[model samples]
Target chain A: MAKGIISWIDRRFPLTAIIKHELTEYPTPRNLSYWWNFGFLAGFVLVLQILTGIFLAMHYKPDASMAFDSLQTIMRDVNYGWLLRYLHSTGASAFFIVIYVHMARTLYYGSYRAPRELLWWTGQVLLLSIMASAFMGYLLPWGQMSYWGAGVITNLFGATPFIGEAVVLWLRGDFAVGDATLTRFFALHYLFPFLVAGMVVIHLVSLHTVKSSNPSGINLEDKDNIPFHPYYTSKDGFGLGVYLIIFCWFVFFAPNTFIEAVNNNPANPLVTPPHIVPEWYFLPFYAILRSIPDLLGGVVAMVMSLLLFAVLPFADRSTIPGGARYRPIYRVTFFLFIADIFVLGYLGAQAPTGYVVPMGQVATFLYFATFFILPIVSKREDKWLRARLPQELLAQFDRTNALAKGQNKGDAP
Target chain B: MSDSKSMDKPLDCPERRNFLEKATAVVGGVGVAGASWPFINSMNPSADVLENAISEVDLKVIEVGQSQTVSWEGKPVFVVHRTPAQIAAMQASKGGPDPQEDTARTQQPEWLVVVGLCTHLGCVPTRDNEGWLCPCHGSRYDNSGRILHGPAPANLPVPPYKIVSSETIIIGVA
Candidate 1:
């Protein structure tokens, strides 16, 4: 009966063929390290987020009048409601952490380079969809942070000339972030996860088309390729186990780790918090946003920070795809870039005043300077690295050739 | 293999083919748009949410020269009990920025009520020593909610409201 159903379904759809092609028989480079596990972990967290979100929605009230009360009810009244809410909320943070690491991994490996630009772009699209979804979802609680955070963000659009007021009104659906904003945000919040899921499909499809770029940033032949089923399936299963343990550790122990204390109170438009900070994931960009003094210029600077990633493929003019591990200078700059972002994030959490302003401005400047200067720096750095790095490539090449000759078959060399 | 049906020209007549193509496109476009209407409509506040939108507040609790912020239809409605001197200052003002009369913003001379949000953006303006100051921007309002200074192009809007009793007021359903 199982065989008959499988055959029937296989005849109608390419179900088995697709599974075999993309999952079981798919060839993945054997040299993928633990860093590659983040992609699967991100995918895992996305699923978890959607599942928890769906359950939370079943009990959630999107109206500004009841949104905070609804969240309270979910926590206090519903069956394991607190668990689901915490899971979803924590899952959002975890998803960002995983995705950021995944992006960093790709950057370090030069995975955004040639023939994989679409894959990188699709990943960016996925990132944007999730970011939008997260932003909209943040408003559903209708807490002080939800109201004021959204107020600050939407007002940023008011910097636009001519139709700025019209745009702000249209986005809010009224004069302010009140009933209309909450209701619309809820609807869009529900809609965007499905959009993210769809984008994930496109992302994965594009990823499989070009395959993956390994740490060495070099293409590996069939000899270096391993089947997905026994090799990666088992590997990913173990990675997921470790990921879940860490994830559930947060979910069970410190569920409110990510939720702000100000959010516990219902939204009071009159009483602004001393500091209106967004979720930690958005802090870096928020820092950049506040770094500029001009309203329109600040908005532009913040937007450019996000859009800078999109142009990385063209700007970072280097043939070395995964050469960061070998290139000492790029390696140091990459870590420094990471450090700069962390500093910006720290600045974002603080009020934009006094010495924090200057520090944030410098950090923000360095953040963009990393991207703008990477191509020029990498051009010089690549030559220096390559002159010293010929032996590493040769060794990798010899290993691939030996694997092709069946000298290193079915073993971890 | 050589049937007349197969031999017949795919676009038998260009006019009919064009009409058919255009008609299909239009029908498909209308169908898609029609399907999207409900999703768009659902985004607005439901009748149930709007049912309890109106809010009533007791004015007895508010003293002279004091302001109270109340939620009406899930937005902050600022109710200020203006002192005689404060009211005079507002009325005596040689208008600043986008000017509006104090009487227009209030139904009673002493009782001033307007949405607390800044006219420039939706941020709630903080009650200041004078009247109100928008923390997000420098937009200021007098005791009567008139835009006094800054980038605000308009005054704080007064929501539909009415005095229901000697000490009670209802906002939103006026």
Candidate 2:
């Protein structure tokens, strides 16, 4: 009976053979730190967003006239609709935070090296797609903020060189971001997250194929690894629980903490707010885009900043197998890269001015220099190491040491 | 012996069974509690009756060539006290405002009683020279609550109304 019950439970649960193999056959480097857990955390947040967003969309009205009223209805009427709305809104912010951390983790660990370059590139594209989805979602409420926000953003196309006017007109679907634009954005915003989910699955599949890199910068050639089951499974669960606690706190108490309530008022096209900033996640690129005086140049520079990640693997030439133990130069460049981003974010928030022009130029220069500087520094470090070891001397020393150790051990016997 | 020892334990442990029972009871309790609110709210004496209540308006408040609005069934109902001259002018401009010129149009003349909502998107139509104008969706309705232009599909709804006193009107469910 006991045997029968055990078999029954195993059959029902059916821990997939793949999972069992991952647990028993494959061994992860034991030295992995908390940073390694972020990818899984990001995946978890993606699920949270998709689930909550789906429910919110059920009661949301796509039409301009009813959109605002529908949101109000959800807030005031539906059972626990307030909770669902808050969860979705707060989940968006939380999603950005986790992805940023995950990207930073990859940067610090040098996880973007050759084999994982495609993974990093895919992730960058995913990030860009997520930003688009979020920006579109912000305009769905048809509130004052949503209206003016869409107007200002869609008008950016008006900055294009020859066809700027035509581009802007096409984007608006009417003369401006009106009912048509709102309906289209609602459709795209609902569709984009699912695409992001598909990209994430590919990211994980790629990640598993190439075993995780650890802090020690060593590869596990033998059976030194353990299955990913009970060990990593428990670890990921604990991390998820802690993240959920923080997520729930924001959902319940401060859903609008990151959003402007002015957005709740009806959108007035005639009135423009003093400062129009994109959501926090896009602030850095938005800053870069604004840095250049020329509209086309600024747009190009902004696109390049995001696309620059694709070139990172070629720029950083360290053959060091593990992720964490980066050379000193790489470490300093990483911090500089972070500082450049912060400076750009600040510049984005400020109006383009005499001081901002120079600051933006300097920040942009440093941003590109970090990528170009990596290959040179990595090459120099490699040569320095090679010069320090002479092959014949190393071989002679090894032979002498072996003979001496053997003789000493034999004498003792 | 190892297998026999394991089998000796019961299929349902008392501790596990008790925990399951408690969990189910807690879930059932919450379900019951949640189900009671709507039931209790529905039972209130005024809940359903108040929604259909009629409103009384003082027609004297409305001057000649002007419109006065009163609440009926949570909606605005417009009552216009027209002068004999104004009624004659409206009749002269008959086909100009009322397109169909049906019985509904013929019925509305000196005292216009129509729902004060835009037939297009349900915004409360603000009174203007051309009768009522919806701020949202830009639908226009003439003084007789006839659809003039824009996307409004039909004319404004006319509430069931009766003259209560010389200067008073009562609007209720027809």
Top TM-score hit: 1
Candidate 2 residue-wise lDDT, A291-402, digit = tens: 6655567677878888888887777665444333546656777787898989988887675555876888788878877777878977776566446667774465345434
The CAPRI-style docking tier of model 1 reads incorrect
Candidate 2 lDDT by residue in tens digits, B1-174: 988878868854999889999999999999999999775443232333344457888877788888877666544677876667656655655433336443454344567788875543244677776577665335677766777765455688777877766787777734
Predicted candidate 1 versus true structure: per-residue lDDT over A211-272, tens digit per residue: 87788776787899998888988888999999889989999998889999988889876677
Model 2 regions more than 4 Å off: A1-15, A22-26, A158-163, A322-324, A385-413, B1-174
Which clashing pairs does model 1 show?
A: none
Q: Give the per-residue Cα lDDT of candidate 1 at A111.
A: 81
Winning candidate number (lDDT): 1
Please give the distance, in angstroms, between residue A247's alpha carbon in candidate 1 and its true position after superposition. Answer: 1.3
Instruction: Please tell me which predicted candidate would have the highest DockQ against the true structure.
Output: 1
**DockQ values, each candidate:** 0.22, 0.01
Per-candidate TM-score against the hidden true structure: 0.79, 0.63
